[model samples]
Target: MSRQIIKDFVYYFSKPLPFNLLRKLTGENFIFPFYHLVADNTPIHIKNLYPAISVEHFKNDLEFLLKNYHPATINDVLAFVENGKKSEKPLFFLSFDDGMRECYDVIFPILKQKGLQSAFFINPAFVDNKTLFYKHKISLIIEALKVTKENFLVSELMVFLDIFSANNKQIIETISRFKYSDTSKIDKIGKILKIDFESYLKKEKPYLTLSQVLEMQDNGFIIGSHSNDHPKFREISEFEMQNQLGQSFNYLNKNIHPQILSFAFPFSDINVPFSFFQFLDTKIKIELSFGTSGIKKDVLPKHIHRVPMEDNLKNATRIIRSEYAYFLLKSIFRKNTINRQ
Candidate 1:
């Protein structure tokens, strides 16, 4: 009757707890039937918002997936294609972005155990084997510049910082209120911000090496592109977007031809227009894509929506229809006339 049911269901999805086993353990399948779970924080806190899992728990899930689930390669999945037929189950795709080395160290093992395939979206820019310190620095800089507690193109924080240092942050903070859309202003900003982008890339962790990414491919994980420098696509111009998208796909294809067929918008948001996406859809049969919204019928064509594993742990409500509930509760909190209507 309420949203908590879904939130609880989401939390449950992330856990290794077998829903059947939990039901057997306790006659009750869910404890929160009315509560709705809202995944906390903006997308800026994507990974950190989720609760942390121990290596052991991560391993258990892998063991379960391997023993129970069905996985396939791109070729194998496309086999579901007839001259033109969609599968019964919507494609079950698992993808990770940013190439967090932890994904390499942490997620790969679980994926391997199940032989459950997924996509690993990596920025060609951050393929070095270290932290993208620039991302963190730019975030602090942006915070200083921002007049409001606005949403961020989160993934770029460290990547941007690689080139723009405190010296640059100081300038951005000073002039941020000016209209960044003006050509002259943008030129000034670009000139001031310019650096040897390639040189700075060497400081961070290089995404899965050609070998590590290829191993995922061999193991059946689809390796995909997340754009060069990983800037938010929505904020940039059509020209900039093309360069970012073109270079990412071009480079990955050159290194490993792991299905250049899929693309994910960088720092996804509802603001990315349907027409903008129509641009991508018309060009490639990008079988799947990822973004910030929860998966729903209306949002189709935007296709893939992702939630982190941590939200499942912190809020039992995430699994039990919490998303629907979160909207309702938020609406009520807003003191709108719709409540009376």
Candidate 2:
């Protein structure tokens, strides 16, 4: 059976029964769920790649969590780390990534209404509309391809990617594999597809401005660095990685006053060198960092793993239950550690 088939089987067959029993037996307590964006009307083409949800669904998610789990803040997690206080109820920390503009216009209002706190991790280069992430450029290009009957050399594009098929899912996956350092090629492809990111940035203003970030900070929300630009750590050299972290911290320090200096890895934190964190220690005091690898405990305690809520939105309860169940199973087999580097 395929992985998805197995995962679906686990999600459907065992959830809320065997899942609950496993959780109770294992004594797992906290979950951190993170998202990329929230929108009431997201384009269908980019939905899978970027993963956004409507305001109504987001509210439903929060209400579900509120009923089943205690919503915790970054401060609460830090306190747990420093003083080791465990919660009596299941705890959750909500986080958003990529610093999209919908965060300010759509998500913040809902969060305010619910009296909840969340952490927003941003790419400094995209904050002031200075530049856009290459992955987003891919999203726009794919959207353009859906509409226009343009005849372009998709095979030429495929040369840079590991993919062989030209299906939409594979296309997005291939686009996702584009190197951050060499975004010029994607930009060239965008130009050929008549999808201009500069125009999009000016017209739509899809990212949060510096003022919006400050307002979020003023309202007691947390802001953390994603990077200067969103790059995969494993693909870049140590010097480039340090520069990305340093420049991002410098930008956030100069603009926003976050109580804790925190960060969430862009793309992922897998295969990252141990020396990277040690280097960050010398430059800045990062209170916490996060990665998306479900409920696994990090060897570095400050580095927390957050579950991605984008997928399995239709069956939130079942999905979360299965994650806990899977955690218990992995713990038994000694396969729970997601990051050894």
Q: Name the top lDDT candidate.
A: 2
Clashing pairs in 2: none
Q: Using TM-score, give the best candidate's number.
A: 2
- Residue-by-residue lDDT tens digits, candidate 1, 1-341: 54446445545453565534433332221111111112222222123223345566545433433343344455544443321223333233456776655667667886677665667787776555433423433433343344333224222332443434444345454444333234344333333344222343454433456677777777767777777766666667767776776777777878878654666666564455655566566754466556544322223433444444344553322332243333333445652111100
Task: Compute the lDDT for candidate 2.
Answer: 0.77
Clashes per prediction? Answer: 43, 0
Q: Model 2: C-alpha RMSD to truth?
A: 3.1
| Residue 46 accuracy (lDDT) in model 1 | 28
Lowest-sum lDDT 10-residue window in model 1: 29-38
* lDDT at 98, model 1: 68
The global Cα lDDT (0 to 1) of model 1 is: 0.47
Residue-by-residue lDDT tens digits, candidate 2, 1-341 = 76445556666656547544655655667778888777767843345374567777877878878877788877788876665434556788888888988889988888878778989999999997888777777778777655665435455555545446665457656666667876987888776566778888888787899999999988889999998998989999999999999999999988886789999999788888988987766577788888887777777767788888887455456557767766766677887775555
Predictions in order: lDDT? 0.47, 0.77
